[model samples]
Target: MKSKTPFIIILLVLAVAIGGAWYLKKAATSQGHGAISNRTPASNTTPPPATAGVNGAEPPHTLGPTSAKVHLEEFGDFECPPCGLLHPILQQMQTEFSDRLQITFREFPLVPTHQHAMAAASAAEAAALQGKFWEMHDLLYEHQKDWHEVFDVRPIFEGYAKQIGLDVERYKRDVNSDPVADRIIQDGKRGHYLGVKGTPTVFLNGREVPFESLPADKLRVLINSELSGSK
Candidate 1:
């Protein structure tokens, strides 16, 4: 009676505001948590290593030498938040240790839990064919948030391939090729054999490292210990 129009309009505005806030919060949570799983399905494709070297997984993407004092084998998923967090720290460790450290990255994409995990791994593997795996790996982790929830990630991945100077057409083909898939599958088999059940699972000299020791300070101490023991 006394002009209920203003009251209804206010209610509508409040509902819209609330809905907007909810959406923003949901997006942030999804982006922050992303896809991190303790157990991932192993790939059924078990082809021979595309290239033989290192730990037997298609020459396996590695930094430093196989003869390095501290060998760190990491099983990681590209879409995983913890793996993303570990990326920079590992980079720092690589610089700090120089040749004393060898870092081997194995694919452990947690499908279903991470819708884009397989795709991301494929992108990295494709880049590997061009000898740009590390570049693509760094880019994917650095900009994880950018394409985390995008409707289509192929274009974004293409942009990354371009940024890393990869042959775009070849990259596209490799992304869907058996060789790339074989590499990932081989890594998965290794991970499974090693009893890995999570992303960022690291093994130092064939011994699994605790999650707490993954940080720089702790990992440095562990590396130093290993170095001393080897001497």
Candidate 2:
């Protein structure tokens, strides 16, 4: 026999290398493809009541009424693909539920991971100063693919501001203002306090909802559940 010992050793080494590769791949996959992976204890299970009302330094972008039975608070990163996907669904929900659903958007830009996220938040906040936040918000999501990867996004954002009837000159200044920066920081702090670890983390009726339940159909069911129970 040609020394079975050597063959056995080679097989063992190969097995270890294969196992290592598999583990690394699985780790990467768990980080999520679009949204940042959820690291909080809130995912897939109901958590404690979320902090109620506007907790940021500035008034958050809100749709519908405060008296609505179901309040949906979304902590989102503009450059996050999953957040972009959730945008339209939430808009539709707002239309369907009308005054019954209150939607509040909070900025939670993931820097480094998403290079343009902070800039996008700045654009929205700047637009808010012009009383056109919702318009800029919609444009950001609608044209996310256009600007997220550009070398510089200021021009694109300025274009959006102008399109929304803002004074582009003021928008340019406000985008870099202390107040704009402060608002983003404040929202991020609130997210951290709430144990949020990813983009598109949503709270429905002060309870964190699972990522799996974020789709239009599933979310509709959740909203309905909240509405019925509030009665």
Off by over 4 Å in 1: 1-56
* Residue-by-residue lDDT tens digits, candidate 2, 21-106: 99987665443222222343223344456665347656778999999998898999889999999999999999999999999899
lDDT for predicted candidate 2 compared with the true structure: 0.84
Give lDDT tens digits, candidate 1, residues 20-71: 9999866642331111112211112232332223344668799998889788
The C-alpha lDDT values of all candidates are 0.81, 0.84
Q: Poorest 10 consecutive residues of model 1 by lDDT?
A: 33-42
TM-score of 2: 0.79
- TM-scores, all candidates, are 0.76, 0.79
lDDT of 1 at 227: 77
- Separately for all candidates shown, the number of backbone clashes (residues 3 or more apart, or on different chains) is 1, 0
